[model samples]
Target: MIYKVPFVEPTKNYRMIKNEIDAAFFEVLSKGDLIMRGQLKQFEENLAKFVGTKYAVGLNSGYDALHISMLAAGVKNGDEVIVPAHTFVATASAVVNAGGTPVLVDVGKDYNIDVTKIEEAITPKTKAIIPVHLNGRVSDMGAIMTIADKYNLVVVEDACQSLGGTFNGKRGGAFGMAGCWSFYPFKILGGYGDGGAITTNDSRVAKMARLLRYNGEDRETGEYYYHGFTCLLDNLQAAFLDIKLRHLPDWIKRRRKIAALYKEGLEDIEELKLPHFDTPGFEDVYQNYVIRTSKRDELANYLKKNGVEILIHWPKPYYSYKALELKDRGFPETEAICREVLSLPMNVEINDKQVEYVIKTVRSFFK
Candidate 1:
């Protein structure tokens, strides 16, 4: 029996990049400025330009980015920050780390924060709202912003999985006051390893983030003034990210095309519920093509047995985590989606043959 191909493969440019990375390493070695050098400046500037933001502060991880952004947003002790119940724990944990309480809200059908319910959670103590763009799908920023304006709350967009996504002509990270991004290996615009950035046009917030990431040092004085985490990004990883950033547009296009193929193949299948693409004028980038089905475990096991690798984007939502466990949490839609959402093979490197195999395998499982 012939087994199906592997699910996803990264666009590894070793042949073209191994030498360049080596050169960068040697250059950094020669300069003896491996920590925060000119390369970091260039990477930060280039990233800001790409995201249409005035500044981009590189950090050790996306969680640090969110934590710093929360600090910049003034989410302090006992303040309530609303977050979607369906997102990764990092989004809520950042709020908690910043000494704020994260009130988990239910999501709508689009797998994003339920903007309709966000207003209901706002109180005098509510300071910020973290709208996570789960699976590269843009959240309803327009309505979210409207609600935020009415209540005087900050909108911190969790754009970790939406590096190349766009909403209403504006980039994903440029919508809110401050946007946090991740460069994890599996993300759309991933780096060599764990990395993250906070994008913002606000000069004050940008400066605070820069200082916050480096032990609150005064760049000019070169003196440690206040306490902050040592989350400065590695220059070597930034170099690799710069190279990958050049080809991100083409990769995004291919991912969108592949998503179209999946829609065409699975739209009529009664066993699965394909994600909705109702947000027009937004380039989603398709980070992970997730589908919901009642027979999720059976389908995943069947595909795995057939060599068609599949995964659940998240088996447990943020509220289910022990640390973030909420009291009397009730979200039927989130629980249902969590139990059923399955991610198929989706990447720029995926070929048409692989797409066909995935469709065939999924169909056979349902049949």
Candidate 2:
């Protein structure tokens, strides 16, 4: 059964830029430079300029970005890296992939890492902190940065969900030692296929990340510097991303408009908790217009049955995963949020009629 409003529609977005994308494809095809060449270099430069970073290295996927960031940050076996317990598993798995132990911490009301709890979790072995900017909302980087400075810990930002989000007028990827981003089709700044990047002001970290993403080889000489993974972003995907980047500002503005509409329609419902779009010192891109309800499962079922497609950002917290060996360790806030949060149909392609239908359907369920 097809739903009236799908959670995301990358194909519709692709169609909007098909001509430009086709042109880019042919240009790259004509050049016959498939790997990291002109298109990838230009994309990296444009992305670095956009995010206010000194360097940006493109990779195959966001997981590679995070994993490469950890390696570049000097995270080694037996070292501990703090990560939010409520995020996508990749946030924590990156630590393990880099040979560091992931120390989980619960998130706060804003659905970001609770900086207050960060200090207690730090130890002699703690080498880094990976703060996930979940739902296109920048985490409290002001506090997280302070803590990192105090502990001399590396801060690798997971800005995959928050390409344009800003805090205190600073871009999401600008505050950390290295920022990892994703171009998964579902993300705010999506690509046609798997793509990712790491941004940083530190030249040393930038160099390491570049090497890590490209088999640790010297780009100019093609000499192997160290053992590394083959994780370069496709030149064609970079071209697609380059075109999409031009419209990101408008896309973010539209997402904010949709969030405003959601709040206007749902704010009065006592049982539902809407996202804090107007948080001081922060500008959210509304990557996923998530709302919380006590009757989450029932409401989701009702919406699905009625032709409105909805989803859960995550049905389980990171700590609850058996592979993490953290069951019963109790992250109450994370657990509660996992059970209640629901992501509505959010994307640039969603029309006003679809938005209103979602609103009406949600209100009908509560009534």
Candidate 3:
């Protein structure tokens, strides 16, 4: 039997909510309330409330969220900010753009920073740690925060993939000094276009970020604060995000249900390493439903031939690239996982039958 499953179909998700989206789309444009208007303010307020933070500054993209958050939290030129090597290059890019050197770290099987090894990597020049919450699972914030407190380092969470995720009863963005989120169309709380936000309880950090996102001009006083970048989240996009935000809780529930199905179907395969299940005190939102296997390349090929679309998060670690020139970085676990990690289709649009077909097809390959 032939089966068709792409990684994620954002169109399908959009179709399901077209009316609400159209209503929001038309409402924003008709009013000509573009650029940091009511919609943006509403979305920011709503996002902050949802993430349990005192502030949420909407930005053009997640990279800006990370970069602005770092600068706001005092990451300076030549300072070292630790990050897991396994995540998207944007995490490291944020560090570089903030004028800090990215100190790459390794990751565990859960696809998050290896908390046990973080302290060993700390240095006197280390100013912060950006524990990327990869694959919709939060890192061990307890360990991360402990290390940060010990070193007096800032904790800027790359919570892009873990919007609805939690660790130890705390939401993804809430655990850090500032948490950065992405609203790319693929994210759980995705928007129609590029959108992102920074969540923070620290009012000063929040204020600084707000200033930096615009031209460093204090809107209230019409005074220039500092030279900043033009990277504000679109008001229309914010309106759309506000609509999607209302549906996020239900979407997260469906995502978790999908994760459960994946775990039940694939856990028996000794060669395949699944992500963590309902470990106590963690509520993973299952952003991509990743699995690791030594036979990743072979399996990926077989799945593609049989029409089960798959993806590798990063074919190689960021530090492996020549442009960055950090080949000396020792991320043993990251080096190992680069050859094995695979992301299965884990979007809300996927039906149970599609998941079953994927599972059955994967089993066929192993046999």
Candidate 1: worst 10 consecutive residues by lDDT? 7-16
lDDT of 1 by residue, 1-367 (tens): 3336555555343444567767877877788777777777888898899889999988888899899989989999989999998888899889988999998889998788888888778889999999999898878888888998998999899999888777788888888889898988888878778999999999988888888888899888998755988898888778777777877888788888999998998888987888756657766878889999899998988988988888786897657756655643588889989899899988776679889889888888877
| Most lDDT-accurate candidate | 2
How do the residues 1-367 of candidate 2 rate in per-residue lDDT, one tens digit apiece? 7889998877888888889999999999998979988888899999999999999989999899999888888899999999998899899889997899888888998899998999989999999999999999999999999999999999999999999899999999999988899999889989888999999999988888778778889888898877998999998899889999999999999999999889889899999999874568999999988899889999999999999888897897767667676534458888899899999998999999999999999999999
Clashes of each: 0, 0, 0
Off by over 4 Å in 1: 1-4, 10-33
Compare candidates 2 and 3 on lDDT and give the better one: 2
TM-score of 3: 0.97
Query: Against the hidden true structure, what lDDT does model 2 obtain?
Result: 0.90
Cα lDDT of candidate 3 equals: 0.89
Once fitted onto the true fold, the runs of candidate 2 whose alpha carbons sit more than 4 angstroms away are 326-328
Better of 1 and 3 by lDDT: 3
True-structure RMSD for candidate 3: 1.6
Local distance difference test scores for all models = 0.84, 0.90, 0.89
> Clashing residue pairs in candidate 3, if any?
none
